[model samples]
Target: MKKLSIILLILGLLTGCSEKGTYIKNTTPYDEHSVENVLMSNEHVKLAKVLLYEDELLAGIRVNTFSRFKKKAIANKIQKKLEREYPDLKVTVSADSKILLETEKLINKKSEKNYRKKIDKIKSIEKEQT
Candidate 1:
């Protein structure tokens, strides 16, 4: 009886202390932009793109010619912060080929009449899924 009680106590404690959420198991990285960051950058935020795949997300932010270097640094810092905030997200880089073309296309459309409309469409889709 004493042994049984001790075993149960140990089991209960182990379960209570265990990791609580789903986490990305692999070391692989992904990249995605924080929409808030782009907004904070004011008009200097030339172009930014975010992509999600499975349990990972990726981001790429482009700056105007005069501020190219600083833009990259800021983007990198943001990426690191995001990774810390979302430890379960496999987060990483800027030039991922899978979404590179799509990102470029999105940036090009920024000046289009329907750009906001398209952004709204994307937001709607994300909203529905979440």
Candidate 2:
């Protein structure tokens, strides 16, 4: 009887200490779906991708410009808009083909390991370009 009571006490303690509340894994200041919507609202953008890493914001946009004069302008507009909304974050936007390609690769990565690897690669590229 004493042994059974001790076993029950241990089990009760273990169950009491176990996790019980809801844990939210996807924590970010910005809503990803909203960011995509805002980017897509611009008519020139063919593709839009956004990633938030800690306090940094990375954006990749592929645009079909009306003329050569508007190519750089479109990228600058995206940067300005994001900067206005997320002033505390380091916002970087690019229309560069390299960045767009890398974004596509990042989007396609299936597993957590591959996703982390791609994020690291994007960070390296951002460092080099900035």
Candidate 3:
């Protein structure tokens, strides 16, 4: 019974430490599969919230706990890579929880009438925080 309990504890810890799946919310006509592939390629990225709006691409990522120290570097690298891939669109990638939450809200809202304005507001907030 004690050995079974120890095994169960080990399994629980392993599952808890594993990376979560990525989430991409693309309202654009572009192929979302490509973007998903790009984001999932990085092993450090655990959870991601991505929004592809008109002329802009915003992404908020949560890295593995151990990789938190270099989260900024990771975000920047991904941003640059995405920018290279889609040069016509403005790309913003952040590791902030506020940005992630806001992006998720925008995705769920499904209203494009004020998307540009909201995105700009989020960008300004990001600038202020940095």
Candidate 4:
């Protein structure tokens, strides 16, 4: 009975550690909800998707504008806000329709590799615009 108690204690400790580790893994560098709220508060934005990957931020936002010329301003505004708020993070923002579509695809295939690829694509797209 003493040996069984010891084994049970070890098992309980192992389970507790796993749960704590999971909480850390799930947490973002910043307050994810507040970040989302800040972006959504913009009058021009319709949809804003923000994901925190460690210290980097990957945001795909859809602004309420049919004019292509207005998109650049909107994207730049978002990029500035994120950079200002999270100086340590490598912030990448996009108002491009193509980037938005790609982001939706990543929602289904969520892997670190996929996020890296998506960020690269968004940056490339951002470069082309600017």
Candidate 5:
């Protein structure tokens, strides 16, 4: 009876747990080298690809982009850069609540150089309110 109870407890613990939220992962093992970065653009249209792939992005990602660039162009540029690094991953541009919700699921990546940007929709509202 004691063994049965122990087995049931173990099974219950293992069955209910899972990792949630968005995150990037290296398909390769530790011996393989890997890098991750997040770029920024003024328009959501520019971030379509990244946002589309938000499921793979961990929080606190660092992305680079040309300052004062068009939305679509910036997205295209980022796609080009990512292609060079990860050709296997398909990237697309999509600006919508679905992608943002996925991004929100990511665990923030921490670094000395903060790449985190203020989400635009909220920023614009603040601007109007002020």
Candidate 6:
């Protein structure tokens, strides 16, 4: 009975750590599938929240615990790659939890009227941390 309990606990923990797929909210004409493919190509990314509004592309990603040390590098690499793919759109990517949470909130909003203002606020908050 004890051995069974132990095994179940381990399974529970592992399941809890499993990665959730990317969340993308796009208001533009861009192909969402291609963007998702680009983000998922990196093995270290655990969860990603992306918002595409007008000419701006903002992404907030969470890396696996083991990759936390290089999370900033990962964010930068994703940003550069995205910029190369979508040169006309301004790209911003960050691995900060605050940014991730804010981006998720933006993605879940019912209306799009204040998207630009809220996005600007989130960007300023991200800038303040640097």
Best by TM-score: 6
Task: Give lDDT tens digits, candidate 2, residues 53-95.
Answer: 5676767776663533575788888788878877877777777
Better of 1 and 6 by TM-score: 6
Q: List the residue pairs that clash in candidate 1.
A: 30-91, 30-92, 31-57, 31-58, 31-59, 32-58, 32-59
Query: What are the lDDT figures for the candidates, one per model?
Result: 0.49, 0.65, 0.87, 0.65, 0.37, 0.91
Tens-place lDDT digits, model 5, residues 34-76: 2234343232222222222222222222222343335335545
- C-alpha RMSD by candidate, in order: 17.2, 17.3, 4.6, 14.8, 16.2, 3.5
Candidate 4 C-alpha lDDT tens digits along 47-114: 66556676667677776646446877887887898788888888877877676666556655646676
lDDT (10s digit) by residue, model 3, range 53-96:
88889998988889999999999989988888888889999998
TM-score for each predicted model, relative to the true structure? 0.41, 0.60, 0.81, 0.65, 0.31, 0.84
Estimate the TM-score for candidate 3.
Answer: 0.81
For model 4, the stretches where C-alpha displacement exceeds 4 angstroms are 1-27, 66-69
lDDT tens readout by residue for model 1, 15-87: 7544221112222354333434533444544444554444555444454557655765655666677777667
Model 1 root mean square deviation, Cα atoms:
17.2
Model 5, position 63, has a per-residue lDDT of 24
Give the runs in model 2 whose Cα sits over 4 Å from its true position.
1-29, 65-69, 112-130
> Mind sharing the TM-score for model 5?
0.31
| Model 3 lDDT on a 0 to 1 scale | 0.87
Q: Which sequence of candidate numbers ranks them by TM-score, best first? A: 6, 3, 4, 2, 1, 5
lDDT of 2 at 32: 61
Q: Where is the poorest 10-residue window by lDDT in model 5?
A: 54-63
lDDT of 4: 0.65
